[model samples]
Target: MVQVSESLFYKDVLLVFFEKEGYVYSNSSPTLLENIAKNLNNLSAPASAPKNFIVVHKKIIATSAFAVGGLVLTPIIVVGLIQAIGFGVGGIAAGSFAAWLMSLNGGATAAGSLVAILQSIGAAGLTAGATIGTGAAGATFMGTAGAKLFEEKSDSIMADLTERMDSNPKGQAQLDEFVKVYEEGNEDKNSEKGSTRVVFEIRDKLLTNNEAFKNFLETFVLAYNASKKLVNKKQQFKFFVDKTDKMDIAGKKLENLNVHLVKNYGAECVDKQAQSCTIMLNCSNL
Candidate 1:
């Protein structure tokens, strides 16, 4: 009767731990429980099982790889965003704009040149101080000129467009038409008609033929895309870390239970060379 009571107590302890860890045990599909038992058994043997046991936790393996990849890629993406916005005013869209800028100045990103300053911002960041400000001021001048055609809310619209462009490429024409109407609707500070409408009356066109405006839009798009991608990657990394932490806690709980069993039931309950304890306390049905 005492032996049976002890067996039931151990089962109850295992079940409680598993339940606390949000694991549901079922005899119909005992794979999860079997895996836990195998891992617990391996934990009892420190010499032969430790290395093999680490490999068995696939989450650890995936998390390690993901962490390394994020570490490597995050800086690159951040730099890309800074370059696109801080220096050029476009994120991913800045690629073409950068090429265009280079082309305009005989394709030379030589020292002290506009392209050189922009490149510096990409490599380091806005923290490059006065040098970065020079590039940003030049980009801002271009952006300000573009801003004249549309209302103050154009910046917000551009941001919305970036997200839309990133999410759906097919909606580009619709987005362009929306921007055209939005710009045309703006009340011109200097004239009765809006800047866009005035331009349309003179040139029979609403879209600015200005290269600066084109480059500004490109830079903004590129920066937004890079920033969005970085955010998503960070969220993914956080999720993996959370899962790893939960697994670590569960493993510790199992180890504590093993210690408890050994203290009350003797060394025979958790044989270091055999997994008799794991089999006895499988808690599969629970």
Candidate 2:
């Protein structure tokens, strides 16, 4: 009877975390997603809050990972809202854009596998003493109250696309061509990380083509525009400087995966790599 009562009781908790612009997500659990969505409006940056606010119950789990040698040590804690506007959704879209990446030898997404994809882009994190689950499927989940998302939430979209690429002969042919080229170029220091390097190399090569670059730019701009709908108008955002450096503005934008700079990207950041530049990332709102 006491255990039943405890199960029904919800413990309230709050977490104030630093909001990194172009990257706002902290976890990939349904509970976190629903929590983030439901409290999107209330996640305003407090006067002293570095980035954003997190109001979660005991149901949510939190974790931090430490990479040592080739192994990752993760400790999880039941804890944590995340959904933020600006580059939050935009950032996620970029990864979704990279989902195909023609698989790394026998992997998918930029992170190798579906699970790795989540970790690579910071979409998912470790669970304290939880199994290292590494598979994905589409489905929806409910929040503690009445929160729900429109789709499988995430990770599913990328996985689904990867699976489909396998059965399509056209995709297979393209994949073969890319694999051949990547392998040739990969003769030097190629490994899993090399796969990531290749992905970027492919983007750079594709962008060099005038027509391809135009289409690419349009696609992302449209995607970003669509993502803006996810952010509530009343919610406010600001950027704080974390690390500073002099580089081309384009480099800064690329470094942070910023989607808000398309309007002036060509006018200001692109092709200015040789010139002096400033490096900045979306920091916790002041």
- Whose lDDT is greatest here? 1
Q: What's the lDDT for residue 156 in model 2?
A: 38
Error of 1 at 113 (Å): 1.6
CA shift of 155, model 2, Å: 5.6
Q: Write the per-residue lDDT of candidate 1 for residues 50-101, one digit (tens) a residue.
A: 2443455444334422333232223333344335433443422333444544
**Candidate 2 runs further than 4 Å off:** 1-147, 150-156, 168-199, 202-209, 221-272, 275-286
lDDT for residue 90 in candidate 2, whole number 0-100 = 32
Clashing pairs in 1: 89-219, 89-220, 90-219, 90-220, 91-219, 91-222, 91-223, 92-222, 92-223, 93-222
Off by over 4 Å in 1: 1-82, 85-95, 129-286
Computed on alpha carbons, the lDDT of every model, listed in order, comes to 0.32, 0.25
